[model samples]
Target: MNDALLALTPTLELPSVAREQALKKQTNISDYDFLLGWLYPEDELLPPNLALFSKTTGPVFIDFLGGKKNHRRQFGGGKGQPLARAVGIASDFTPKVIDATAGMGGDAFVFATLGCEVLMIERSPIVAALLQDALNRAHLELQLEAEGKTYRFDDDEHSFLTATISRMQLVNADAADYLNHTKPEADAIYLDPMYPEKKKKAATNKEMTALQGLVGPDIDSSKLLEAAMTVAKKRVAVKRPAKAEPIQLESGKKPSASIQSPNTRYDLYVVASTQS
Candidate 1:
């Protein structure tokens, strides 16, 4: 089989060890070999197409199952903001969004609709490659179906997904590894790791169950906020269970001073940069 990537841009590389470790974490008996577009020899699904999710809108249930929202109304694309809104990201639908982890790209798509220029970074090679593919296909189809419209994908000059959401950029890279170095000051940064679901809602829907077989749990999710703090021009928003204590604050790193929405209980950490 040709390891020759099918796309038109440079494939994002992963640390061989991390890639192996990440892949090993996949609970599937057959690996995500399908990501390479390997024809599945059995009766199972291939990597998902963007079209399936292209139509999704309104409050994102995918996040409710996994527990995160990428684009809040404050960012212009959310039905509701993430937990961090209490600290002051606000519900006015601020501006652009950077989705550090694109898992299934559900959150990213929501923000795209709010007309935010969303920059989505995903680390898994198969997942990234598949997202790029779907974005490319959907971007092209949407463009062709319209007049004088285009969005870049496949490393092209413009993307339809970007145009559809006003503007978007999908960069293939590890969420933790990439955000550590990136400094694009977005209005908001959204982070949602695969948390242990509340037992009441443990049985996930079909797509999520499939996603679980792919990305596994976001084992390194805790580190995302610190990185987001340094980059986001506005705030670092994390969505958590309504009952769970705020992530870093629970450990006492954040000051005792609190913000609004204490009753909702999810926390939003306002990085100093966005305040200006």
Candidate 2:
């Protein structure tokens, strides 16, 4: 957990099912300082959400059902988005993607919304738990909608969100280790290893600030990139700050191509062959 001050708080008076699941997650995390607790909504209709109660950053949780994520899922440029293009998404093809450093799952959800099957790998157990909780809640909402019950979104939007959520899968593991052991099946590998915080830019969002504090930087990103290149069947996409230099591989190799957006760049390494 990168030596972050984190701990599981006592489960609140949640619905029976949600309480059980929260307890399981609490048991899974071995070390932490403060608390892992639920933030109950004032609206009785809204469900209680699992959150990491950080003294420095307040509560941090992943919410795919609403908020910025849902808004992006609805309006974020479809396949035309830079992230989609970087992963080789086209009208004729939608690549299965493995997100090697799936911090907070923002990018993974975007890929899923674009109709790509996305495997999100997060090394931090705390982040992984939050992601899993969000996925579970999203799936439950989808199931309720299918049963002709109350849903958070309208019918059309419900259908779209359901499909998007269904396409995403999460795993808590070291990216390099997972990629090295798994078969080279995914068409693209996406790496968004954390970069050092820039001094000149405005402070990052609380979610990102908390994440950086917990996971720290990916010092071994170059090695992870190498492993991803070996495992990815078609290409490996490394997301970098627009002005930042590309990751330096131990093999002295460089990205085959680069795709740029206003604030970010995707360094593409087209895979030539797979290692045995």
Candidate 3:
């Protein structure tokens, strides 16, 4: 580990070469020493318990993974369900989705679980690296945890769907660049840029702050919306504080329906309707 990276945790003393391996495998300095996580709670690093969530009891960890994945989500009120249900691209056909703003891979995974081949483009190298690490480590068993993540989200027993979803890929790139330049085939484009907390008392997720440090501002969020609207066949779904107005608020497009959750709201822009 670089001395600077080690400064974060003394136990994370991987050499450059070994650190590269750990990053590739999604292992962190903390993985080498779970105690780092305990000591540096302010660093926003999760406990080793998160290292291999596939082994946890039933859906508790899995569901927690989903919530952590969706930083905008809270514990109760089923907020994630409705947001995941949102599909607003103007598409003549249904196919894969492009999560342009894959903040922490939560929305991207949601789009994937919805059966869309999600091509996630994350702007921040560090965030992208972290996400890749999580997905990569999830696919393998580790000493600190059990049952690698598999990346196969499906639950079919008789079929390979449980493992087939490993096909999803994460890319390190700015969302605006991909949308404006690439002519990739996609049915829907999703954007969930971080917004101001709904209320002053609102609690911001630490993981979110960690991501923000890596990924500066969505400086061109408006342009992202424009490109997504132009490309997506169905519609563009933007996650916002339930109380906050739409990101592209002035645009004539209003959300088809707003799903209310205890913490956040799903602002859905319907380019067109889908089977759901």
Clashing pairs in 2: 6-32, 6-33, 8-36, 9-36
- What is the TM-score of candidate 3? 0.60
Local accuracy of candidate 1 as per-residue lDDT tens digits, 1-276: 223343412453311112222334443323332222222213232222221111111111122111233233224334454333432333576467888877767667666655567788887665666566656545444554354433212433234333544455788777666777767768778776677545476456655655555567776666777777777766666756556666653235562233334333445667665444
Off by over 4 Å in 3: 2-80, 88-95, 141-165, 196-199, 249-257, 272-276
Name the top TM-score candidate.
2
Query: What tens digits encode model 2's per-residue C-alpha lDDT throughout 1-276?
Result: 211112332122111123333445543333433246666665554556767644356667888878888788778988998999999999999999999899888999999988999999999877887888789878876787678666567888888888889999999899898888876479999999898776797878878988887778889998899898888888999999998998987788888899999999999999877322
Q: Please give, for residues 133-178, the per-residue lDDT of candidate 3 as tens digits.
A: 5565444322122243233233342132233236357888877777
Error of 3 at 99 (Å): 1.2
Clashes per candidate, residues 3 or more apart or on different chains: 11, 4, 15
Q: Tell me how candidate 1 scores on lDDT.
A: 0.52
TM-scores of the candidates are 0.61, 0.85, 0.60
- Measured by TM-score, how close is model 1 to the native structure? 0.61
Give all candidates' CA lDDT scores: 0.52, 0.79, 0.52
Estimate the lDDT of model 2. 0.79
Q: What is the lDDT of residue 182 in candidate 1?
A: 60
